[model samples]
Target: MRTYSLDDVYETRKRRDSWWTVYFVDPVACRVALPVANRTRMTPNGLTVLSLVLGMVSAACFAANHLIAGAGFFYLSFMIDCVDGKIARLKGTGTPFGLWLDYVGDRIRVVLCAGGLAYGQYALTGDVSYVVLGAAVAVLDLFRYVNAPQMKRVREAVREERQEPDLLADADPLLGPDPLLGPDPLLGPDPLLHPDPLTGPDPLPGQESERAGLGRTSRPRAFFRLFRRLNRFLARHRVRSHLVSGIEFHAAVFVIAPIAGAWALIPLAALSGLLLLANEVFLVYRMWLFTRRHGAGSPQESREHVLV
Candidate 1:
């Protein structure tokens, strides 16, 4: 009802629709209850640790073939996952450590869900599909981290290149007329146009110095200009935008879709894993293209200097 920032929307989404919610919708009111429960007591960090414990118990219950009960515990675990942040927000104790803990806890909850489902299937029907699917999802998480480094490097490089001199050309003559001229007007003479005694002679003795300095860049530099134009276009709308879309897909299809269905659960779980992995590969290719066009050292240096 009140005005909320993008961060608020993201926080709310993280609480309500995560991997934990996928397989566990027991009480249905868990989402509503989380914030309230958190208001009574406990820090976000405490709630996160509690959520992990609850998630483990939920997995154990599922392994024992207690479907409804396991689901219920899983739901509670998900609720706690939501509560941690709510509690942090309420107590005004949100911190980087709390954020990191929540992220790690969320991943662990997903693992617990996959493991619980597998264990449930093994107990109920002895099928190994769930376990295998769980493992696959676990492995796929690496993609997000893998592509992150490359993207970071690319972004850093772009930032530095954009920071290049604002003037159209790199070698603007106005910068320095001559090494010997030194800015003092009182100097014996403007050193720039003066012929250096050490050199044999100017190519064209009669012509002025400005005439001889007409062309600073060669053909290769012109080619770089064209490449820079293409790079600017891609950076504005293609590579980074696509990665953002992939992340949105990861949240919606993999996490939210399963919560919306029962039978769709397993399929969504598998699909999410694959999509996340594909996103990583896409990122790698994008970064590789950048590196090839620019240089690896440039990108790497940019990444190293990046504060984010």
Candidate 2:
């Protein structure tokens, strides 16, 4: 059996995980589960598959408005989602297939959960706002999924070029960022695209995370009066804001708002939509600025740029 310390598990995670997860959710969840998981022959992929199974069950409960069970399964699945990677770190057996499974599974699981919320609302109150709210949340959620990896690819590409001037020069030249990758098979088979494994779309390139201490780049230095507070705040907190935003927003509609009535979805949708608009605007502007500042150079210099 494999054995590991808490540090072994958590050290492998991204530095900028949600504040709540870092302090509360992940610590207890991953550490507690890892010991048991290590003792079993179960691989990290096994744990991920189990999480997906639980998510499916939770989705069913949500559709039926079985909030208690739905919440229970949802939390359990999330905990497992956190644990699987930690387990993989301990085992040293991660694979391309496992990465793709985890990525695709996350998107599918979230959509299913959101669909459940919509179904619950329609069943409980016969209101159509459920449908609208569900669609909006799905769009925003998918946007985030697409946005994160693509930006990461851009940042890492720049970093790589800086690190190896001789190497990148001999390699193929850089292509400017495209928010969307080419469509994957609606039905069948193909191989290589971007040679750099980090930019894969169907199964995104893996993230290399730093510690929170290393993650302080987002914040602006105090007493720097040039940029407005709002822009400064957005730059500083953008990544952290996204960590819990989707889950919390859905928890309201699927878990709390359901208690009020389907009508509650209307206001919730409005709030979510407003936030989505603001964030998208900020993201597009940042991307534009990043491309302009970097100007197809390989310095990987972050300077005032929120590339991702």
Candidate 3:
């Protein structure tokens, strides 16, 4: 049998991850993953399958009104889900099929758990609100997953445009020079002076100064600056800035709510959903402002800003 260290397990972990996983899940998961990686021939796909099975068991527990048991099983399932990715990164055994399976399995688990919790509560109390709550949980979970990728694509597109040589030239008058490249003396004088044929003539002096002022004043608001500082602190601990993300949402609904008992479930879930929605909307608005400010150019020039 091969030997594996805790350090090795940590190395396989994501550089930036949800705060819930970083604080609540990863500590125990890394320990679990180390032994499994060393002692078992189980592949990442195998762990994913096990996680899915555990999730089904959790749903069954919830349906039976075994709330505590259900919460325990759900947490275990999620921990295993975390472990599989760690093992995949550690062993280089990740497959495209495994990725698809992981994604599909997560969706199925959320749907089943939501249905189970709602039905169980409704069965006990004969309240239709339980059903509504369950539906809301499932819908919100799906919405987050669906929307996150599209938002990520938009951010990436903006980044790509910023990096393109031609698009950068077009954006320079408004957004200033690329911080990474600094002034390229090799390009011969400044493009602001010579002006690229494709990009057209330079802006008026007043226009240039106005844009510069706009860029200067476009510094993030105080709240966002504080948020960024908090993220920087979290980064030191290998956690991402999204404090209440999908993982936390699931935890609030399935784990925390159940532990707090039936009375607390709806309020807790609602609050979690609202926070998640607010965070997402804030991100989308920021992206919109970024595009508006930096994306003022021809359609051909605009298309250049896509990242992978």
Candidate 4:
């Protein structure tokens, strides 16, 4: 209730929400933004829009081949991206609009930043490869986005089933005020720790059999056992993630891209394409596997299609 500069939003975040962000950009930004959050009229949605604007400007700078300036904006945008969530947590004014704003802003920023960098490189060097690379990144990025909401549901469902099976009758408990993560930060707002705000319609509730039993599946027990373990692994790991994580991709853009000079995106394109492909494949696999258990007529089957 005492929302003010005195609050250290970082203290309230989930451990898995942050790892590198906690180490690198956050401390300085938190010191600067906490007071602003207390004094300014900027809401979390405003911050989300601001971050997107900064990213666009940064991309413009990169397109013009201003590497250092682009990096400066990139980090600044990232820092503010972090700050918005802290403010949201501090003020406790998160809404679905703000959540969606934050999520869309992140996706747009990635497109602009990567595209701008590639175009700038091509402009400077007159190579079409950079242009191709940028396009490829965008395609992979789109593919990754399609599955984001689905993967999020799968993880949330799995996590909930393990913790409070009874409460899962309600739709994605986290989609509303998430008790597990606390106030959303940015996209994840939980920390890299953020939620992917791409929630689709919740899977329709089916009999208990849909979740764990396929009508005529060969081995219900073993199938569910493996399914739980796979889902658990995907949900728990911070590093690998299901795919489309920003850490490796961001590092490449901000670090490797600059260091490599004109060829920054060559490896980045490869990395992104592979990761997106893998993620889409896994998403499809999980959908098929889960739907099979739930049966074709079940609601989960229909819900999973929207995720695609």
Which candidate's TM-score is highest? 3
- Return the top candidate by lDDT: 3
Candidate lDDT (C-alpha), each: 0.48, 0.56, 0.73, 0.59
lDDT of 1 by residue, 1-308 (tens): 23333344234322112222323331343344354443345666887898889878766765565555656666566667655655455345667777677767766765666676666665666667767765765555544544454455454455366664211111112222211111111111211323221121234555545443557633333443344444334433212223332234334433354346435546776665666567456546544544455453455556566534
TM-score of structure candidate 4: 0.65
RMSD to truth, every model: 17.2, 12.7, 10.2, 8.8
Off by over 4 Å in 1: 1-39, 67-72, 157-266, 279-308
Ranking by TM-score: 3, 4, 2, 1
Ranking by lDDT: 3, 4, 2, 1
Mark the regions of model 3 whose C-alpha exceeds 4 Å error after superposition: 159-220, 296-308
| Whole-model alpha-carbon lDDT for candidate 1 | 0.48
Cα error of candidate 4 at position 220, Å = 15
Sequence-dependent TM-score of model 3: 0.78
What is the C-alpha local distance difference test score of candidate 4? 0.59
* Residue clash pairs of candidate 1: none
Residue 226, model 4, lDDT: 53
Tens digits of per-residue lDDT for model 2, 177-223:
21222111010012121121111223224422321133454232121
Query: Whose lDDT is higher: candidate 1's or candidate 2's?
Result: 2
Question: Candidate 4, residues 85-158: lDDT per residue as tens digits?
Answer: 77776666778777778878877888898799788888888888888877876666666565555555654554
